[model samples]
Every structure is written in structure tokens, then in C-alpha cells.
Target: MNFEAAKTLCRSFPGVTEDTKWGNDIVFSVGDKMFAVTNLGEATGMSFKVEDERFLELTDRPGIIPAPYLARAKWVYVEDAKALGDAEAAELLRRSYELVFGKLTKKLQREIGGA
Candidate 1:
């Protein structure tokens, strides 16, 4: 997928917001916690949070690796977005968004719902 596609998919979820940061990276966040970010020059690649098990499994595949600086935090980088397929990428993004969103306060969760 590309930037627009990624952005579109990411924003489809509740409480998602987008902004460009870190010079050229576009970050998607929920309640001030980032779930994904643009990487590998523009939108050719992406980094997002994943389960520890999936992080190890995904990085074993081509075009994926541990994210720079955030590897220890269980973020995985997709070197070539196409390698991830559209459906799976969307699922992963949704999962990441949910994971971060789940950490929000109960009041914040209610706010997100009302958003």
C-alpha cells in the first residue's frame, strides 16, 4: 500500500488522527499514543506496533524488520508495503490501533466513542 492508502485505512478507525513529524514521517495516533508511522522515505514503508510473537514471525519474512529505535517496544517495519498485502496490512493497523487505544483511560475511551 501507499501513503494515501495507509492514511485512509488508518483513519477509518475510531479516534485516529494523522500528522507529519520527525521531518518526513506521518504518524497515526489514538489518544496521544502512536500506533504507526511512515518510514523508508515517504510512504514506501511503514512501522507499527504488533504482538511480540507476530513481530518475530513477521520480521522473518522478506521486506519486514524490527523498527529502528522502537524495536524493543515491539514495533515492526514493513520495508515494502506491497509485501504485506492490503487486507493483512489493514488488519495489522487495526490491531495496532486497538492495542494503543485499549491503554487509554476509561474517560478517554468514552471520548473516542463520542468522537
Candidate 2:
């Protein structure tokens, strides 16, 4: 998907926020934590977190790769947007939001819940 489409999808998540971080990378967040990031200026790819098992399955798929440095645990990179359709991209974003939200502290969860 194009940048605008990507941004639109990301912003649909509850409390999701976007900004440039780590040298031109576009980062999407819920609360203060990141769930997805795009290297639009340099790599033309997006990095996102998935369950460890799911991350393995996705990285094994064609055109998907383990995100550099961040892949040791839960991140994967979509090397080309064309390899993933809009539905898949939205699913990934949803999974990421769930994963990150699940990890938030009880107080934070309550705060986010109130939002």
C-alpha cells in the first residue's frame, strides 16, 4: 500500500499515534510504545511485531524477512508492500496492536481502557 493508505490503516487502531523517529522512519504507536515502523525514506519496508511463532511463519514466507536487529524476538520486515495485500497489512497491524497492548502494565491498561 502507499504511504497514505498505510497511515490511514495504522491510525484506525485505538489511541494510535504517528511520528518520525530513528532517522526518517515513520513510527506508529499506542500510548508511548511502538507497534509498527516504516523505513520509507531508505528501505521501502515496514517493521512490525508479531507473536514469536507467527513471526517465524511470516519470515519463512517469500518477500518477508526478519527485521534487522529487532528480529531476534518478535519483529519481522515486509520487504515489499506488493508482497502483502491491504487485508494482510491490516491484519498485521491489528496483531501488533493486540500484542503491544497485552504487554502494557495494569495501570496503563486501565488508562488506555479509559481512553
Best by lDDT: 1
Q: Compute the lDDT of residue 1 as modeled in candidate 1.
A: 52
For model 1 the local lDDT of residue 72 reads 100
Task: Give the lDDT of residue 45 in candidate 2.
Answer: 79
Candidate 1 structure quality by residue, lDDT tens digits, 1-115: 5655877788788888888787788888999899999843446788999987898999989889999999999999998766787888888888999889988999999999998
Q: Per-residue lDDT for 21 in model 1?
A: 85
Alpha carbon lDDT of residue 12, candidate 2?
82
Give me the displacement of residue 25 in model 1, in angstroms: 0.7
Kindly list the per-residue Cα lDDT of model 2 for residues 1-115, writing each as its tens digit: 4545766788787778888887778888887899988865554778889988788788888878998888985898887777678887888878998899888898888888877
The local distance difference test score of each candidate is: 0.86, 0.81
lDDT of candidate model 1 versus the reference = 0.86
* C-alpha RMSD of each candidate structure in angstroms: 1.8, 2.1
Residue pairs with colliding backbones in model 1 are none
